[model samples]
Target: MPDLLVGLVVLVGAVVQGAAGYGMNLVAVPLVALIDPRFLPVPLLLIASAHGLLALVREYGDTDWSGVGWAMLGRVPGTALGVLAVATLAERPFSVVVGAAVLACVVLSVLSWRPRPTRGPLLVAGVASGAFSTAASIGGPPIALLYQHSPGPTIRATLAATFGLGTLLSLAGLGVGGQVHLTHFVFAAWLLPFLLAGFLLSGPARRFLDGGRMRVAVLTISGASALALLVRAAVG
Candidate 1:
């Protein structure tokens, strides 16, 4: 039943990501914490990495390699900071951190902020992405916000390229920190099919979501879930 619930969550997240460019982990992390906080950071990272690969395949030609490179350069230290976070924090506290990060992303998304995909901005986004992604598996907002003003294909493709590689770096850092374990893979394996299904559904959903209509709804739901997660963590 837990597996089924998580699969459903991943499916919804993947579909949102497919249509919207960057929302899989943002949607998945907080709700998944409600079901089980331990199924985070690594397991969701694995699923997100897979989703990014699928996104890359469809939009590879549109990828901005220059932007991806700049982001990756900042990701190294960001990942290190993430590793340190995981090594020091306990389960409930870590869950609170994840919830807080998600809340912050939701707040940022609604702001009148319109950051561009310039090199300096991309570097800063990359660093933020790495730290958030490594720490909480919620890395999409920083980079996605930067590329939000770009063309749809460019947004999807560029973010995919950056996240695909960045997720790997995060995994490696977690592994070195002794946080990666066989159990994480076991959980990720359970969500594989749903992730694919969500991507498939994206072709149809993108038309509806492209006009920026869904952004408010998505952010609202994400914020609520994040708040719930924070409450749950605090209570526990």
Candidate 2:
């Protein structure tokens, strides 16, 4: 039953991410963590990597690889820091911190504060994304904020490409830290079908979600999910 619930959550998250360019971790990680704590960080990172690859292919022409390279450079050190956090911090405390950070990002994005995607900002965003994503499996907000004002296809494609590479680094960090196991891969495999289903469903809805109103809605949903994680951490 828990697995089923997590799968459904992942399906919904995948659809949102496919259309919006980001939000899968924000939407699904909190709910799925409640269902099964073990199905986090590493497992979700694996699934996200796959989802990102598919999204990138669908919007291949829109990808901005130059920016992605700088982000990857920043991610290397950030990922190392995240692995250290995962090894040291208690789960509840880490969740609370991650939730707070994500909420803060959403608020900033909501205020129409569009930071230019210069090399410095992209690198900074990448560092933050790598740390948060490696620790909590929720890394999209930082990168999403950077590209929020761009065209929908560019946002989706660029983010997909960045996440594809970033997640690989995250997975490697988890593996070296002994946080990943064979079961994580098995669980991710089980959820792949649902993820693919949601991706397919997003094809027709992509245009609809690309509107300004829909972008606001997506940010709201992401904020709400982050709040949920914070509340859960507090209560637990």
Per-model CA lDDT versus the true structure: 0.78, 0.82
Tens-digit lDDT track of model 1 for 1-236: 87788889999989888887777765787678778877887888888889899999997899999999998988888777776786787757876876787678667767765567788988877787777676666677667766656777777888888888988887777688799999999988888999999999998887776567555544554576567657767887
Can you write out model 2's per-residue Cα lDDT over 1-236, one digit (the tens) per residue? 99999999999999888988888877787788779877886778889999999999999999888888888888888887787898898978988988887788788777766666789999998898888777766677777777767788888898899999998876776677688889999999989999999999988778887666455655765587678768877898
Q: Model 2: how far is 225 from its true place, Å? A: 4.5
Candidate 2: residue pairs that collide: none
| Model 2 accuracy (lDDT, Cα) | 0.82
Give RMSD (Å) of candidate 1 vs. truth. Answer: 3.5
**How many clashes does each candidate structure show, in the order listed?**
0, 0
